[model samples]
Target: MIEVKQLTKRYGGTTAVKDLTFTVDPGQVTGFLGPNGSGKSTTLRMILGLHEPTSGTVTVEGRPFRSRPRGLRHVGSLLDAQEVHGGRSAVAHLSALARSNRIPRRRVDEVLERVGLAEVAGRRIGGFSLGMKQRLGIAAALLGDAPVLLFDEPLNGLDPEGVKWVRDLFRGLAAEGRTVFVSSHLMSEMEHTADQLIVIGRGELIAAESLEEFSARGTRQSVMVGTPDTEILRDLLAAEGAAVRADGRLLTVTGLSAARVGEIALVHRVPLHHLSTRSGSLEEAFMELTADSVQYLAGEPR
Candidate 1:
């Protein structure tokens, strides 16, 4: 488990992270999410001891990271896949990291194969594709067989297949009782990949909850109905306290179910053409939940 308490960071007069506190539990994939420049990267840097926090503390298990250089054996992280030496082969890089930390040499081959990089073990890092680089990064993170893993945009340059592969890897890790924390800007990816979410905005915590809880209480549902007499149906639905909007050949209605809509069309002598129900999507919920915290909003009225 990773615990952060009252963590804050400042650069001169500007605050980057403010009294942030959250815990990442094991056996679940926790998504660290925020808009651009919202201090998500800064917080991760602090956790890794790359940047000293202006105040507060972060601990893995119960020990400070710096106090325990071997602590990484329990908490593996992949912040940048391209940070490796360009001259080294994939196997060489992992072997060097393990040698430096006194990790066994055999573990290098194990993780390489685990992340599907064993086929390219002899290839130089400079010649590897972005997807291959990502795989190598995962191998490095798993070299110590860590129970807690942190990934920052692991799918950044991956194709559709690579994206799916990373998603499955994360899920598989969490299923094995490991703590998986990932930070990404892609809402679609997070929607399907994460079991829990830790959202931050403007250097403050926005929410820390399950995805189900984040999207559970929606006030409106999207309902689509097709009918030749859309106008008559719209009037009937509106009179029944439902908001109705007509779009081309279909009528969009809220506050009414497909069964009720069919009965309304039948009783009103309007022919029912089609009916479908759409619950709000995770993308919609994310936007609504983080609108105020978005640092940049495009096409704003000037």
Candidate 2:
């Protein structure tokens, strides 16, 4: 597991992260979410010991990452897929990492094949597309077979198939009791992949909870009701303090449950064609929760 407690970082007069505390447990994929300039990259850097915290602590498996000699054996990370040398072949690049970490040379081939890069193992990275580079980066992360892995935007340039492959890979890794922490902007993907979430905004911790719990924080719950007596039901529901929006025979209601709507409709003898509850999505929850934390705002278009 990875533990961060009261972690803070400052560059000159600017504070990037402040008193951030969260634990990424094993046996599940934990998603790291934040808006742009929210210090997500900074926090990831600190966790990998690439940046020193001005105060507080972050540790993997009860110790700082820097304290580990062969770091890749314990923590593997892919901060930037584009940071690799473009002149080297995929195999040669991974081979160097394996040698530095005292990992077996054969492990390079295994990771390459696992990431679907074995066919292009001899190709120079400069010739690879962004998606292929992403695959190669994932291969490097898996080279050491580390217990803990951190990925920043691993799905940045992946196609639909590659995205699904990555999702399955992370799940498989978690099933093996490895700590999988992913940082990405794709809420739909996180909704399907992550078991838990660590949400931050403006360098401050907003939430660190299960995906369900975080999603429940959104206040946009509504019940969809289709009825011929829309006007009558709308009036009746309005009397009960429910906010209702109507489109012909359909009524979208907030501030009430589907069961309550059904009961009200039945008591009023209102004919109903359909009734269903619509819970807020992860993207909706993120937008509502992080509204104030957004650094750049675009004006509404004309």
Candidate 3:
């Protein structure tokens, strides 16, 4: 388990993380989410002892990570996949890390194969593609076989198959009761991978809760009704005080449940061609929650 208490970090006059308090429990995949410039990377660095907090504390298994001897054996992290010696072969890199950390050399081969890099284990880091580098980074992290793992943007350069493999890998690690924490700006990926979510914005805590709970904060449930009698259905729904809008053949109805909408249509002899309820998507909820926290905007707004 990992615990952070009132954790804060600063760089001169800038604050990267605020008084954030949260816990990452084992046996679950926790997704760390935020918009650009939200300090997700900085917080991960603090947890790994790479960045010292300006105030407060972060501890792994009840103690500071920096206080641990052979600390790499307690927690493994992949902060930057490219932060490796370009001249070293994958085997050479893992071997050196193992030797210095007192880890057995055999685990090096085991992890290389586990991450599907066994065929390229002897290849130089300089020639690897971005996806291959990510695999190598994951292999390095697994070399320690630590109980806690931290990954920032692990899927940045993965193909569809690689992405699926990574999603399964995270779930498998959590199944073994390890604390698996991943940070990414991709909500669609998180929707399928994470069991829990910790969202932040502008270096401050926005929410910390189960994925279900976080998605529950989305806009009220709305139903899409399609009918040949658009004109009649619209008038009837509006008469019931439900907000209704027409988009092509679909009538997007809000402020009423599916049953209510269907009942109203039937009462008026309206023929229904289609009807389905759509609670806002995870992406929708995330945007609604973090709209104000987004640090930048694209081209001119509509």
Q: Give the root-mean-square deviation of each candidate in angstroms.
A: 2.6, 2.6, 2.4
Checking candidate 2 for backbone clashes, the offending pairs are: none
lDDT of 1: 0.87
For candidate 2, write residues 1-302 as lDDT tens digits: 99999999999999999999999999999999999999999999999999999999999999999999998899989999999999999999999999999999999999999999899999999999999999999998888899999999999899999999999999999999999999999999999999999999999999999999999986589999999999999999999999999998999999999999999999989999999999988999999999999987779553
Q: Which stretches of candidate 3 lie over 4 Å from their true place?
A: 229-252, 300-302
Best candidate (score: lDDT): 2
Which candidate tops TM-score?
3
The candidate, 1 or 3, that scores higher on TM-score is 3
Model 1 stretches with alpha carbons more than 4 Å out: 226-252, 255-263, 273-276, 299-302
Name the TM-score of candidate 2: 0.91
Q: 101, model 3: CA deviation in Å?
A: 1.3
User: Which 10-residue window of candidate 3 scores lowest in summed lDDT?
Assistant: 293-302
Kindly list the per-residue Cα lDDT of model 3 for residues 226-247, writing each as its tens digit: 9988888998999899999998
Superior candidate under lDDT, 2 versus 3: 2
Model 3 TM-score (2 dp): 0.92
User: What order do you get sorting by lDDT, best first?
Assistant: 2, 3, 1
lDDT of 1 by residue, 60-132 (tens): 7777777766755877899999998989999999888898778999999899888788888998999988888
What lDDT score goes with residue 132 in model 2? 96
| Number of colliding residue pairs in each model | 0, 0, 0
TM-score-superior candidate, 2 or 3: 3
